[model samples]
Target chain A: MDLFGQYVVNGLMLGTVYALVAVGFTLFFGVLDVIKFSHGDVLMVGAFTGFTAASGAAALGFSHPLAQLAATVVFALAGTAALGAAIARWLILPLKSAPRLNILLATLMLGTALRESVRLFYPDGSNPKAFPALLPTSSWQWGQFTLRADSSILVVTGVLVIVGLHLLINRTRLGLAIRAVAQDEETARTMGINYTLIVLVTFALGSSIAAVAGVMNGLYYNEINFGMGLLLGLIGFSAAIIGGLGNLYGAILGGFLFAALQMIGAVAMPFASAYKDVFAFAVVIALMAWKPTGLIPERASDRV
Target chain B: MDAAIEISGLHAAYDKADVLIDVSLTVAPGTITCLLGSNGAGKTTLIRAILGLTPPRAGSVKVFGAEVTGEATHRVIARGVACIPEGRRMFPKLTVAENLRLGAYQEPSEAEIKRRLAEVYDTFPRLAERRNQLAGTMSGGEQAMVSIGRGLMGKPRLLIVDEPSLGLSPLYVKENFRIIEGIRARGITVFLVEQNVHQTLAIADAGYVLSGGRVVAGGTAAELKSNAEFHAAYFG
Candidate 1:
C-alpha cells in the first residue's frame, strides 16, 4: 500500500476499535441517560480475562490458534457482560433516584478501582502483557501497498460486529424495547416493557461489544496492559459526544473522525507523533465550538 | 359487572408526604369517569396506583375485581389497561406504526396484533398516512392522535388517559375529547384524568373532584354540572 493507503488502513482499524467503544457509550446513554465511565476499564478487564482464558486453553491442550482465540473472545464477552450487568443491577439501578453526578462519580471511581486491581493483583499486571499471536502474519504486497492478514481479519471482524449490533438494535423487538425505554421509561412500563431488564441488557450488550474491541485491540497491537482502557475510554467518550451522545450513527461517525484526526496529526508531524492526541483533541474542541450539539446533531422530535 | 377500577381507602406517598390520602373512587365498566383536579391534586397518583407505578401504601385496588396493588406496572397493563400519560410521552424516535405496535406488546398473535393495528389506523386515518414518520416530529395534535391511537391498539378493557389535552390548542382539545368519546363508545372504560373541567364533564358519565390528596367531591356528570357552588369554583 502507498503511504496514504497505509494510513487509511491503520486509521480504519483504530476507528473500528474506537467506534465499538463509542457505540457502547451511546447505547448506555440512550437507555439510561448515564455514561458508563468504567466502560474502558471493563474493556481492559475483558482483555485480561481473554488472556487468562487463552492460557487456560493452552494448558488444556487446545493447540489450534483459532480455537484458542474463540475461547479467549467468548470468555472476554461473558466476563465483561457479567460485570456490566452487575454494575447496572446493583450500582446504576439503585442510584436511579440519586443525582446523576453520583452515578458519574461512582462509575469513574469504579474505573479507577478496576485499573488498580488489574495493575496491583494480576501478577506483574502493571507491565504490558504479551498478547498471543494467533492470526496468520502473512501480508499481501503489491508495489507500495501491503495488507497484513491479522490486520485484515481484525478489520473485517470489527465491521461484522458493528453490522451485527446494527441489526440487533434496529431489526429486533429487544431493540424496540431499548429505544422505548430510552424515550420514556414510565411510558415503556405502561406498554408492558420491563425497564430494569432493558437497562441490564443494554449494559451487558454495551460491555460485550467493548470486550470484542478489547480482544481485537490486544490482537492488533500484540500487547495488553491494565491501563489501556483509560485513554481508550476517554477517546471513545469524546467520539460519542462528537457524534451526538445518544445517537448510534453519531458514535460511529465520531469514532472514525477521531481516528482520522489522529492519523492526520501523525502525518503532519512525524517527529512529535506523541502529540497527535493533543492535535486531535484541539480540533475536536474547535469542532464542538462550531457545532455544539454534534456533527449529525441529535435527532429531534418536534417539541410542543 | 365488576368495576373496571376500584380504589378504596387508598394512601399513596412520594417519599414521606402522602400524595393520595384516604382516596376512594370507582370507575364503572364502559363509562367515562373523569378525575377532575388541578396541579398537585393527586390524580396522577391515583392513576399510578391503578397501574402499579406507584402502588398505594394503604389501599385496595381492583381492576375487573382483580387486586393489583403493588403489582408490576406491565402486569397491571396486561390485565387490559392502557395509559395515555401526561405530556403525551411518545417514543419520539419511533415511527407511528412502532408506537402502536408497542401498545399491543403482550399480544401473542401477530395476526391479532395486525388486526388491532389496522383498527387503530382505521380510527386515525392521519396516523395511517404517516405510519412511517417519527412520532415526535409530528405536530402536537398529531402526536395526541398517535398517543390515543396507541391506547386503542391494546384493545384494553379500561383506558387511563392522563391529561390528553396537555399543551394543545382549543381545536385539538375538542378533537381529542371527541376521539376519547369515540374510545368510550367502543365499550372500553375510560379513566379520564383532566384539569379541563368543562370539556371533561361534558363527555363524562360520572366524575370525582380531587384536591390536596382527597376526594373533594364525587357525583354524576349532570349533578356536578348542575351544582351551583361546584360550578362556580371549577367550571369557570
Candidate 2:
C-alpha cells in the first residue's frame, strides 16, 4: 500500500509539470488553430533563464533560498513571456496567409534554432548544468508514507496555479475576450476586441506558465540541459492531443493520465520500465483511434 | 445632413479579382440605408470593405467625417461601428451572455458593460431567459436575437447588419426587420445589406442597387419601389 502511495505521489508530481506545459499547448491551439511546435524549447529557455537568474542572485549575496526562488521565477516568467510574444508576432502572425504546413515546418525549424542557440551560446550548455537547490531539503513521514517537503511545496503551488488559471479563464473579462476570439476571429474583431493584442497576450500567458513549469522541473530534478525540452515537449503535446486539443481541462486531465500510464507501466512491467513511453503511446494511439476528438472533445462544431 | 458613413469612388478586390469598382454611397446619420443586390453582386464585399476587413484599392471611406479607409477591423470598430455579420455568426460554444459581453469589448468599465447588458436583456427578453445557455443550443430565431443583442451592446453609432433575414422563417424575418426598425428608431445609423429586396426597402430611408461590381441605381426607398427597372431587376 505504501509503495502504491509512493508511486501515486511521484506520478502526480510529474503530472503537475506536464499539466503546466500541456495547458500552454491547449491555450495556443484555442486562440490560433496552429500548434506551436517550438513550445518545448520555450520551456527550456525558461529553465535556463531561471538557472542564470538563480546564479546571478546567489552571486549578488541574495543567498536565502526563498529569495533565490523568487528571483528565478520572476525573471524566468518575464523573459519567457517576452520571448513567446515575439515568436507569435514576428514568427507566427506574418504567416497568417501562408499554407498551414509551411507554418508548422517554420515553427519546427524555429524550435531547432532555439535549441541550438541555447546549446551554442551558453557556456557548456550542451552538458547538463547542476540546478540550485532552492527548495528546502526536508521530508514528512506518516506511517511509511513519506512526502518530501520540496515536492509538497511544488505540488501545492502547482494546484494553486492551475486553480488560478481556471478562474482567470472563466471569471475574467479578458478570458471572455479570449473565448470570443477563439470562437470566431472576424466577429471578435468586429466586436472591438483587438485580435493581435489577444494573440500576443495568449502567447505570453502560456509561455509564462511554461516558465513556472520549467523552473519547478529544474528544482525537482536538480539538473537542466539544452536538449531536455525535446522529449518533454513531445510528451506535453501528446498529453494535449489525448486530452483533446484546444480544451483546457482536457490538457490537464491528459497530463495526469499520461503520468498514471507511465507509473502503471513501470509497476506492471518492472523489467522493461524504460519502455514506459512506448506503452503509454500505444495506449494513447488506441484511445485516439477509438475516440479521435479526445476524452473531452472541444465543444465547438468543426463546421466553419 | 451629416453622413454617418461615406464612400466615394471605392475600388476593392479579393486577391486578383476586383469586386467593387467606382462605388459611391452615403449613409445619413439616424437613417437606415439599404444596399440591395443579388447573390455575387458584391454586397458582402462592400460591407467588408466598409468595416476594413478588405482594404479598398482606391477611394475614401469616412465614418463620422473621419477618413478611415484602411484601418484595422478592431480599430474601425473602436471608432463606433459594429457589424452583425451574415448568418448571425454567434460563438456557438459560448453562452448568450458571453456573446453579449464580447460586444462591449471596448467598453472599459464594468458598470458600463453591466448597463449595456441590462439594456440588451430588456430589449430581448428571450435572450435574457437564455443568457446562460450556449448559443448553438438555441433556436435560429433566438440565435438571431442574441446576435442583434450583441451588436446593440456596443452602443455603436453605425450598425452594419449583413443579411439579418437569412436562414430565418418568415415570422422570424418579420421580427428581424422589426428589430432593425427599432434600432433605427433609437437614432442609430444603419447600413443594411440584403438580397431580400421588398422587406429591406419597406424600412429603408434610401437604397442602392449593385450589379456586376457597380452601383447601377440609387434613390430614396419609395422611388426605388416605384421604378420599373428596380422592380424588374428584383422581382422579375
Candidate 3:
C-alpha cells in the first residue's frame, strides 16, 4: 500500500512537468499549424540558462537560493522567448506557405544545431552536470508514505503554472486574439489583427512556458544536460497529442496519465525499467490508432 | 456623402488566372449595390480584391475615398470595411459569444465591445439564445445569421456580403435578404454578391450584371430587371 501511494505521488510530480512541456507543444501546434520539432531543444536551452544563471549568481555571493532560482526562471523565460521569436521570424516565416515537410526538416535541423552546440560548448560533452537545488530537501510523513518537500514544491508550482496559463488563455484579450488566429488566420487578419505580431507572441508564450517546465525539471532532478530536452519534449508532445492538441486541459490530463503509465510499468515488471521509452511510445501509438484524434479531440470548428 | 466603395480600373488575378479585369464600380452610400452573376463570374474575386486579400495587379481600390490599393487585409478592415466572406467563415469551435467578441477585436473599449455585442444579440435573437453554443453545431441558416451579426459588430461603413443565401433553404434565403435590407434601412451601404438574381435585384437600389469578369450591364434594379441582355445572360 505504501509503495503504491509513493508511486502515485511520484507519478503526479512527473506528470505536472510533462503537462507544462506538453502545453507549449500543443500551443505552438495550435496557432502555427506546424509541429515545432525544435521545441524540446529550446526547453533544454532554457534549463541550461537557468542552471548557469543560478550557479553564476550563487558564486557571485548571492546567498539566497530561492531568489536566485526565481531570477533564473525569469531571465531564462525572457531569453528562451526571444530565441523562440527568432526561430519563428527567421526560419519558419519564410517557409510559411511551403510544404509541411520542409518546415519540419528545418525545425529538426534547428533542434539539432541547438543541442549539438550546447554539448560542444559545455565543459562536459556528454556527461550531466549537477543542477543546484533551491527548495528544502526535507520530507513530511503522510500516513504510511514519506513526501519530500522538493516534490511538494514541484507539484504546487506545477499546479500554479497550469492554472495561471489556463486563465491567460481563457480570459485575456491576447488569448482571444490567439484563439481568433487559430480559428482563421485570414479572418483574423481581416479583423485588423496583425499576423506577424500574433505569431511572435504565440511563439514567445509557448517557449516561455516550456522554460518553466525546464527549470522545474532541473530543480527536481538536480542535474542538467543538453540531450535532456529531446526525451522530455517527446514525452510532453506525446502527452499533448494523446490528450488532444490545442486543448489545454487535455494536455495536463494526458501528462498525468503518461506519468502514471511510466510508474506502473516500472513497478509491475522490474524488467520493464530498461524499456520505459519503448512502453511510452507503444502507448502513444496504440492511443493514436484507437482514437486517432486523441483522448479529448478539439472540435473542428476551431480550426484556422 | 462619400461613395461607400470606389474601385477604379481594378485588375486582380488568382494564381496567374485573371479574375477581375479592369473592373470599376462605385457604391453609393445608404443603398444596396448588388453584383449579380453566375458561379465563377468573379464576384468573390472582386470582394477579395477590394478587401486586399488578393492584391490588384493594376488600379486603385478606395473605401470611402481612402485609397487602399495595396493595403493589408487588416488595414482595409480598419477602414470600416467588413466582409461576410464566402461560405460564412465562422469559427466553428467557438461559442456564439466567443465569435461575437472576435468580431469586435478592433474595438478599443470593453464597455463598447459589450454594448456592440448586446446590439448584435438583440438583432439576432436566435444567436442570443445560443450564446454559449458552439458555432459549428448551429444550423446553416443560424450560422449565416451569426456571420452577418459578427460583421455588424464591427460597425463597418461598407458591409460586403458574398453569397449569404448560398446553401440556405428558401425560407432562410428570404430571411437573409431581409436582414441585408434591414442593414440598408439603417443607412449602412452594402456591396452584395449573389447568384439568386431575382431576389437580389428586387432588394438592390442598383445592380451590376457581371459576366466573364466584365460589367455587361449596369442600372437601377428596375432597369436591369427589364433589360433583354440581363435576361439573356441570367434567365436564358
Candidate 4:
C-alpha cells in the first residue's frame, strides 16, 4: 500500500475514535451547558471492563469471536451507562443550581479521582496491560491500499452511531424535549418536559456510546491503561470545540478534519509527529481566535 | 361557571426584594380583564407569580377553581392555562408549524392536535403563509403572531398574555390587540397585561391600574376611563 493511501486509512480510523469520544462531550455540554471532564475517564473504565470480560471469557474456553465481542461490548456499554447515571444523579444534579465554573471544577476533580483510583487498584500502576485481541491481527491489502477489519468496523460503527444520534435528536419526541431544554430550560419545564430526566438520559446515552469507542480502542490497540483517557479526552474536547459544541454533525466533521491534519502533519514532516498535541491545541486555539463561537455555533432562539 | 383566574394577596419577592405586595385580582369566565401598569408596576411579576415561575411568598392563585399556588409553570399550563410570556417566546430554530405542534405536546390525539393547529392557522393566516419558514427569521410582528398562535394550539381555557403589543409597529400593535379580542370572542378568558393603557381599555370589559405592586384603581373600563384620577395618572 502506498504511504499516502495508508495515511488516509489510518487517519479515518483515528478520526472515528475521536468522533465517538467527542460525541458525548458535545451532547452533554449542549444539553446541560457544562463540559463533563470525566467523560473520557468513563470511556477508560469501559475499556477496562471490556478487557477483563473478553479475557475472562476466553480463559473460560469461549472461543467464538462473535459471542465474545458482543458480550464485551454490551457489558461495557451497560456498565458505563450505570456509572454515567450515578454521576448525573448524584454529582451533577446537586450542582445544577450552582455556577457553571463549579460544575466544571467538580467534574475535573471526579475525573482525576477515577483515573487515580484505577491506577491504584490495578496491579501494575504505570504499565500497559494486554487487552484481549477480539479480532484477528491481520490486514487485507487491496492493490495500493490495505485495511484492517477491526479498523473498518470502528469507522462504520462510529458513523452509524452518529447518524442514529442525529435521528434521535431530530425525529423523536425525546429529541424535541432535548433540543427545547438546550435552548431554554425554564421554558421547556414549562412545556411539561422533565428537564432533569432528559439530562440524565442524555448523559447515560452519550456515555454508553463512548464506551463502544473505548472498547474499540482497546481491541484495536491491544493495550489498556489508567491514564489512556486524559490525552484522548483533551483531543476530543478540542474537536468538539472546533466543530461547535452543540452541533452533532459539526463535531463529526471536526473529528475527521482533526485526524486528517494529524496524519498529513506526521507524514509530510516527521518533526510534526512529535508535536502533534501542540499542533492540535494550536488549531483549536486558532479556530477559537478566528471564530470564537465555533465553526457552526448555535443561533440564538427567539425564546429566552 | 367560575372565575377563570383568582388571586388574593399574592405576595412574591425576588431574593429579598419584594416585587409583588398584596396583589389581588380576578378575571371572570369568557371576559377580558386588563391589568394596566407601567414597566415597574409589577404586571410581569403578577403574571409570573400566577404561572408559578416565581412562587408567591404568601397568598393563593386559583385557575379554574383549582389552587395552582407553588405549581411549576408547565403544570399551571397543563391545568388549562397558557401564557404568551414577555418577549413572545417562540422556538426560533423550529418552523412555525413545528412550534405550533410543540404547543400541543400535552394533547391526547393527533386528530385533535391537527384540528387545533388548523384553527391556529386560520386565526393567524400570516403564520400559515410562513409555516415552513424558521420562526426566528420572520419579522418581529410575524414571530409574535406565531407565538400567540402556538399558545392557542394548547387549547387553553384561560390565556394570560404579558405585553402582547410590545416591540410592534403601531399597525401590528392594533392588529395584535384585535387578535386578543378575537381569542376572547371565541369564549376563552384573557387576563391581559399591558402598558398601552388606552388601547387595552378600549377592548377590555374591566380594567385595573397597578401601582407600587397593588391594584390602586379598578372598575368597568368606562368607569376607570372617565375617572379624573385614573385619567390623570395614566394619561396626563
Candidate 5:
C-alpha cells in the first residue's frame, strides 16, 4: 500500500509539470487553430534562461535560495514571453493567409533552429547541465511512505498557479476579449477587440507558462539538457490531444492521465521502466482512435 | 446635412475579381439608410469595404467626416461603428452575457461595462433571462435579439446591420424591422443591407439599389418604393 501511495505521489508531481506544458499547447491551439510545433523548444530556451539567471544570481552573491529561485523564474518567464511575442509577430502573423501546412512546416523548422541554436551557442550546451539545488531538500516519512519537501512545494505552487490562471481567464475583462477572439475572429474585430494584440498576448502567456514548467522540471530532476524539451514537448502535446486539444481543463486532465499510465507501466511491465513511454503511447493511440475529439471535446462549432 | 458615413467613387475587389466599382453612397446622421440588392449584388462586399475588412482599391470612405478608407476593422469599430454581421455570428460556445460583454471591449471602465450590460438586458428581457445560456442554444429569433443587443452595447454612432432578418420567421422578421426602426428613433445612424425590399424601404430615409457591382439607382425610400425600375429589378 505504501508503494502504491509513493507511485501515486510521484506520478502526480510529474503530472503537474506535464500539465503546465500541456496548458500552453491548449491555449495556443484555442486561440490560433494552429499547433505551434516549436513550443517545446521554447520551453528548452526558458530552462536555459533560468539556468543563466541562477548562475548570475550566485555570482552576484545573492546567497539566499529563495532569491535565486525568484530570479530564475522571473528571468525565464520574461525572456520566454518576449521570444514568444516576437515569434508570433514576425513569423506566425505574416503567414496567417498562407496554406495551413506551410505554417506548420515553418513552425517545425523554427523549432529545429531554436534547438540547434541552444546546442551550438551555449558553452558545452550539448552536455547536461546541473541545475541549482535551490529548493529545500528535507523529506518527511509518514508510515511507510516518504515525501520530499521540494516535491510538496512544487505541487502547491502548481495548484496555486493553475488556480490563478483560471481566475485570470474567467474573471477578467482581458479574458473575455481572449474568448471572443478565440470564438470568432471576424466578429471579434467588429466588436473592437484587437486581433494582433490578443494573439501576441496569448502567445506570451503560453510561453511564460511553459517557462514555469521548464524551470520546475529542472529543479525537480536536478539537471536539464538542450534536448529535454523535445520529449517533454511531445508528451505535453500528447496530453493536450488526449485531454481535448482546445480545452484547458482537458489539457491538465490529460497530463495526469498520461503520468498515471506511465506509473502503471513502470509497475506492471515485465521489461525495463524506460519502456513506459511505449506503453503510454500505445494506450494513447488506441484511446485517440476510439474518441478523436478527446475526453472533453471543444464545444465550439467545427470550422468548415 | 451631416453624413454619418460617406463613400464616394469606391472600387474594391477580391483578388482578381472586382466586387465593387465606382460605388457612391451617403448615410445621413440619425437616419436609417438601406442598401437594397439581390444575392451576389455585392451588398456584403460594400459593407466590408466600409468596415475596412476589404480595403477599397480606389475611393474615400469617411466616417463622420474623417477619412478612414483603409483602417483596420477594429479601428473602425473603435471609431464608433458596430456591425451585426450576417448570420448573427454570436460566439456560439460563449454565454449570451459573454457575447454582450465582448461588444463593449473598448469601454474604459468596469462600471461603464456594467451600465451598458444592464441597458442591453433591459432592452431585451429575453436575453436577460437567458444571459448565462450559451448563445448557440437560443432560438433563431432570440439569437437575433442577442445580436442586436450586442451591437447596442457598443453605443455605436453608426450600426451596420447585415441581414438581421435572414433565416428568421415572418413574425421575427417584423419584430426585427420594428427593432431597427426603434434604433433609428434613438438617434443612432443605421446602415442596413437587405434583400427584403418592401420592409427595408418602409423604415429607411434613403435607399440605394446595387446590381452587377454598381449602384444603379438611388433616391428617397418613397421614390424607390414607387419606381417601376426598382420593382422590375428587385421583385421580378
Candidate 6:
C-alpha cells in the first residue's frame, strides 16, 4: 500500500510537467490554428537556460535554494519567451500563407536544428548534466514509502504557475485579445486588435509557461540533457491532441492522463518496467482510434 | 471636411474573375448612405475592398479622406472603421460581455473600455442581462444585438454595416433597422449594405443599387424609390 501511494504521487508530479508543456501546444494551436511542433524543443531550450542560470548562481555563491530556484525561473522564462516570439515572427508567420503542411515541416525542422545546435554548442552538451537541488530535500517516512518535500514544492509551484496562467488568460486584457484572435481572426481584426501582435504575445506567453515546466522537470529529475525535449515534446503534442488541441482544460486532462498511463504501465507489469513507455504509447494510439477528436472536443461553431 | 468613405474606379477580383468592377460611391459624413444588392451583386465585395480584406485590384479607397487602398485590415479598422460583417460572426466561445468588450479593443484605458462596454449595454439592455452567457448560444435576434453593440463599442466615426438584416426575422429586421437609424442619429456616418430595399431606403438618405458586380444606379432614397431601373429590379 505504501508503494502504491508513492507511485500515485510520482504520477501526479510528472503529470504537472506534461500538462504545462501541453498547455503551450494548446495555446499556440488556439491563437494561430497551427500546431507549433517546435514547442517541445522550446521547452528543452528553456530547461537548458535554467540549468545554465542555476550553475551560474552556484558559482556566484548564492547558496540559498529558493534564490537559486528564482534565478532559474526568471532566466528560463525570459530566454524561452524571447525565442518563442522570434519563432512566431520569423518562422511561423512567414509560412502562414504557405500550405498548412509547410508550417508542420518548418517547425519540425526547426526543432531538429535546436536539438542539434544544443548538442553541438553547449559545453559537453551530448551528455546529461546534474541539475541543482534547489528545493528542500527533507523526506517523511510512511513505512516503505518516502515522500520528499522537494517533490511537493515542485508540485505546488506547477499548480501556482497554472493558476497564474489561468488568471492571465481569463481575467486580463491580453487574455481577452488572445481569445478573440483564437475564436475569429478576421472578426478580431475588425475590432482593431493587431493580429500579429497578439500572435507574438501568445507565443511568448505559452513559451514562458513552458520554461517553468522545463525547470520543474529538471529539478524533479535532478538532471538535464540537450535532447530531453524530444520525447517530452512528443508527449506534450499527443496530450494536447488527446485533450482537444485548442482547449485548455483538455490539454491538462491529456497531460495527467498520459502520466497516469505511464504509471499504470510501470505498475501493471513489473517485469518490463523499462518498456512502460511502449505500453503507454500503445494505449494512446488505441485511444486516438477510439476518439479522434479528443476526449473533450473543441467547442463547435455552426454559424450560418 | 471629407466624405466618410469615397471609392473611385475601384476594381477587385478573385484570381481571374472580377467580383467588383469599377465601383465608385461616396458616403457623406453623418448620413445614412446604403448600398442595395442581391446575393451575387458584389455588395460584400465592395465592403471587403473598403476594409482592405480583399484589396482592390485597381483604384483608391479613402476613409475619412485618407487613402487606405490595399492597407492592412487592422490598420484600416484602427483608423476608426468598424464593420458589422454578415453572418453575425460572434466569437462563439466568448460570453456576450466578452464579445462586447472586444469591440473596444483599441481603447487602451481600462476605464474607457469599461465605459464603452457600459454604454453598449445601455443600448442593448438585453445584452446586459445576458452578459455572462456565451454568445454562440444566444438567439438570432440577441446575437444581432451583440454584433451591433460590439460595433458601437468602438464608437466609430463610420460604421459599415454589411447585411445586418441577413437571416433575421421580419420583426428582428425591423428592430435592427430602427437601431441603425438610431446609430446615424448619433452623428456617425453609416454605410448600410443590404437587400431589403424598402426597409433600407426607409432609413437611408441616399442609396446605390448594385447588380452583376457594378453600380447600376445612385440617387436620393426617394429618387431610388421612383427610379425606373430600381423599380423594375425590385418592385417587379
**B115-183 per-residue lDDT for model 1 (tens digits):** 998888888899999999998789999999888888888889999999999899999999899988988
Candidate 3 lDDT, B1-236, residue by residue in tens: 67888888988887878887888888998889999999888998888788888888998988898998888888888988888888888888888888888878888899999999889888888899999998889999899988998899899888999999999999999999999999998878999999998899889999888888878788899999899999888876
Tens digit of per-residue lDDT, candidate 3, span A57-132:
8988887988788778888899899999999999988899999889989999999999999999876757897888
Each candidate's DockQ score against the native complex?
A: 0.55, 0.64, 0.58, 0.33, 0.64, 0.53
- Model 4 alpha-carbon drift over 4 Å, by segment: A51-63, A121-129, A135-139, A272-274, A299-304, B226-236
Candidate 1 local lDDT, A1-304, one digit each (tens): 3988889899999999999999999999888888889999999999999999998999999999989998999899999999999999999899988999999999999999999999999999889999999899999998889988999999999999999988887777888888888888889999988788889999999999999999999999999999999999999999998988888989999999999999989986665878899999999999899989888776764110
Could you give candidate 6's per-residue lDDT for residues A196-283 as a string of tens digits? 9999999998999888888989988999898888899999999988887888888989999999999999988765788879988998
Q: Alpha-carbon error at A71 in model 6, in Å?
A: 2.9
Which pairs of residues collide in model 4? Answer: none
Which CAPRI level is candidate 1? medium
User: Between which residue pairs do clashes occur in model 3?
Assistant: A183-A304, A301-B92, A301-B93, A302-B93
Model 1 chain A: which ten-residue window has the lowest total lDDT? A295-304
Give all candidates' CA lDDT scores: 0.90, 0.90, 0.86, 0.82, 0.89, 0.89
Q: Candidate 4 on B1-236: residue-level lDDT in tens?
A: 77899899989888988888887888999989999888898888898788877788999999999999998776788888877878888777777887787777777688998899889888788888889888778999888888788778888898889999999999999998898999999889999999998899999999788877878888889998887777666665
Per residue, candidate 6 scores C-alpha lDDT tens digits across B1-236 of 99999999999899998888889999999999999988888998899899878888999999999999988888898888888999889998899988988888878888988888888878888999999999999999999999999999888999999999899999999999999999888999999999998899999999999887888889999999989998766555
TM agreement with the true structure for every prediction: 0.93, 0.97, 0.93, 0.90, 0.97, 0.94
Interface RMSD of each: 3.3, 3.0, 2.2, 3.7, 2.9, 3.7
Question: How many backbone clashes are present in model 5?
Answer: 0
* Local error of candidate 5 at residue A182 (angstroms): 1.4
Look at candidate 5 and tell me the lDDT of residue A111.
89
Model 1, residue B144: what's the lDDT?
Answer: 90
